[model samples]
Target: MGIADLLSDVWGTFSHPAPDAEAPPTGGSSTSSPAAESGAEKEENKKDAKSDDGGEQGHRPSEGGDEEEEEEEETVDPKDTLEDECKESKECQPAKHHYDECVDRVTGQIDNDGKASEDCIEEFFHLAHCATQCAAPKLFAQLK
Candidate 1:
């Protein structure tokens, strides 16, 4: 539809909602649609659903709040963890330096197409391998 028609529909929705948007007339044979329920009524329905099945469908807390706190407390950014481990690893220094140099060299070189003339995938892989070896144990230990 055109923009004008779309805007008109939106305006009409706010200015004058559809008849079906209102709750069904009370004390009648008509069934109420879920959409017709108010927020409070919906919440009450959720509570009733919980009671119907012994609270299985209810909004319940985690089995142990300690687990939640432990998870939050131990949450470390992987990037930050890797960088910290790499900084302390002597074996990763040379590969990291080489990768940085290769990146700088490649980015500084421009071809006739005005793009990087070379990629440093090999250097990057070397750096990544070294870093992963140094960081894996420490990172994986946290998984448990």
Candidate 2:
């Protein structure tokens, strides 16, 4: 059969389901379609979401409320992070000693090899010490 005939037959059969089927019977006094109520609910949800976002940003807090204090607490200055890095690097005196030991170890390995040139050995130890004691994981990541 042609597509038109197939569609018409389906349309005729679909006018009503058996009375005991899952769906509520189609004929009713209600003015609204089920699809229309879903659309209206979507619009209401969008309005509620927009209102919440506006409350977060636009409405000015009156006289030191919880929101304003929370906002102030959340902010962090860039200098604070820089100061933290500086304090950590400066206060850790043991790392300098650790780096010196690393240099000595690498230099010893270089000297143990009979054919390695002294100048190349010095350069390798310098780099190896920096990579090890200063930033082992960072150096390993770069190698990978």
Candidate 3:
């Protein structure tokens, strides 16, 4: 019937469901792929740019055994990653509603407290957790 039905049927067929039944969902991208491909593509573009400038069409510098550099990869921020993922959704009201509620709640409070309410922050974070991390980096980079 639907994807959920198909997933349920396939999962049901497996006798041993494994020990970690409460594992988080793996959105849909391999951890190494986008990073690797992006590096390769970036190199390709750089080479192309150099040649297009009428300079000697020289051999592109090889990424020779750059394993160590890769190992020293920097960590990305979780909030930034979540923001990136949220941008890709076709439609999402949670963030907007959360923001509006925060504004409304603060404005209506009239307590002279110059702070947004906790309920708004909680709702926003809850909605954010549901966002997939697959396209986060790309989305964040583009926005920047």
Candidate 4:
């Protein structure tokens, strides 16, 4: 399965509590008869049942939380993060300059047209590849 699917499954499992484990019972009479004990247990079970139902209902997000999270992940630009990293390194100045210029040019083009052209996309990728090549040798080697 994809990362999105895996994350959704994990989120669902964590958000809901286990069915079998219920909260411990509160104060009860110490000298209760067998019938009274059973009845009391049933009453407690009923109260617990309502609470458990409410918990499950309350935990569910009104919006599609999983989908929103996946969308956020998709929208994140790796190049932005890499550019920031490059800015922090003196050795990566040349790469950082190229990356910043590429981003600026591509962003302006997309902003004007409302969508990226194939040529713009190709050029952005090529500039990004060059920036990667120009990055600090130790850091770039670790990325491989």
Using lDDT as the yardstick, the better of models 2 and 4 is 4
Q: Model 1: how far is 100 from its true place, Å?
A: 1.1
Candidate 3 lDDT over 11-114, as tens digits, reads 88796676867888767765345564577576675667766866654345557855445466798876676665564554345555666677678777656676
Best candidate according to TM-score: 1
The lDDT values for all models are 0.74, 0.54, 0.62, 0.62
State how far residue 112 of model 4 sits from its true place (Å).
Answer: 2.3
Question: Mind giving the per-residue lDDT tens digits that candidate 1 earns over 116-137?
Answer: 8678999988877777788887
The residue pairs that clash in candidate 3, if any, are none
Clashing pairs in 4: none
Candidate 1, clashing residue pairs? none
What lDDT tens digits, residue by residue, belong to model 4 across residues 37-115?
5665666656666779646422334374565654344665555666556555675556556666777877788899987
How much is 52 displaced in model 2, in angstroms? 68
Clashing pairs in 2: none
Whole-model lDDT, model 1:
0.74
Q: What's the TM-score of every candidate structure?
A: 0.43, 0.19, 0.26, 0.27
Candidate achieving higher TM-score, 3 or 4: 4
For model 3, the stretches where C-alpha displacement exceeds 4 angstroms are: 1-89, 110-118, 132-144
